[model samples]
Target: MILAALAALNVALAGPWPALAGSEDVVVEGAWARASVGTSRPGAAYMTLRNTGNEAVTLTGIMTPIAMMPEIHRSTTNDKGVSTMAPAGEITIAPGESVAMAPGGLHAMLMRLQEPMNEGESFPLTLTFSGGGKVIIEVPILKLGARGPEG
Candidate 1:
């Protein structure tokens, strides 16, 4: 009885299980999207991806039902103090490492939004990896001008 109680507690504390059994090498957390302004067709999503396995994984693609087109992007500022956003073809995460997608850096770009993403709403984002692994995560929409998910 004690063992059973401990097992239950472990599972409960672990939260939701991975999508695929024995495929919990990669985990995503703290996913969020910035609230959209009126008539804005593009938005960005941010998350932290961690790889706990002994192998590296490459994030290749992203898809979302709320957007007509989804792509990975990286924001950079040049020497002239000009900020530009460009497509990030792919991102790799080494074993036992974590990658953060935050503002002014790497993010998932949602183009041609089907509808305005309002605060307190959530949407699904499907991420595909190079090794045929895929994970569907629900990203929450935060207030406009929010810097991070903490808000």
Candidate 2:
């Protein structure tokens, strides 16, 4: 009876579980940018990252054609009830596990924007893994409210 109940509970929680990706694997899906029309000096991009490699890897740096510096950033809460985005030195993805970089969490902070980011446009992005492998991806800029399709 206990075992059966545990199985049922697992099934319920599994619905929201994250998918795993390989070590040499770098997948940038559901990439989107905020859609606040007109004024756009700086904007952020969000996506999900899965690393399925035998060895642990860290996301060390980023490169983009439009931005001067593309850095890894995470959102944190302070004691004053204020939220701030801080620069992350590196993000480690353990072997056989995955990392998700999405809105309200870890994300790529595109700073020193050279041009305005519009919806439905794709941009070139290069993510450097700690193990010396670089993944070049074409990230589609989408509206802020857009979300990845549920599997």
Candidate 3:
């Protein structure tokens, strides 16, 4: 909800954020990752995927050079306010719709890191879709505790 509101305000106040060029109809924006303190812990990444095509697309797989295991996950808060995260498998986006991967929601989990992700550094993350083909976006590494991409 927070990321959606921020995006809406950005569009209303300024304009739509520029999308990362892709091979198909899905465009990505605001791709970022939090800097890792060391190689022991996994890192999380976030982005928004917009579908501009007429058909629905399912995001199937993810890959990045920084980690050995990159996967999609969804975080949810239960009725008791306990938060849990689980593997998301695949996500389908309808035509003209969008899926936002923000904090406390759907996001990418970069696990088994080969090296620590430092602030101000960036890496390419490849996402494969069932209908929309594939997209490789550059995800910037922000502060260790950043909740969202830097403005």
Q: lDDT rank, highest first?
A: 1, 3, 2
**Model 1: per-residue Cα lDDT over 1-151, one tens digit each:** 9999999997786565443331358799899999998536699999999988888788889999999899999999999999999999988888899999999999999999988999999999999887556778999999998899888
| Poorest lDDT segment (10 consecutive residues) of candidate 1 | 14-23
62-84 in candidate 2: lDDT tens per residue? 89987887788898878997888
Query: Per-residue lDDT for 5 in model 2?
Result: 100
Task: Report lDDT (Cα) of residue 47, candidate 3.
Answer: 96
Better of 1 and 2 by TM-score: 1
> Each candidate: what lDDT?
0.87, 0.70, 0.87
The segments of candidate 1 whose C-alpha lies over 4 angstroms from its true place after superposition are 1-23
Candidate 3 lDDT tens digits, 16-117: 322332338888989999999999999999999999888777899899999999999999999999999999998988889999999899999999998899
For each candidate in turn, the TM-score is 0.82, 0.72, 0.82
Q: Looking at candidate 2, what is the lDDT of residue 12?
A: 81
Candidate 1 TM-score, C-alpha based:
0.82
Off by over 4 Å in 2: 1-23, 35-40, 144-151
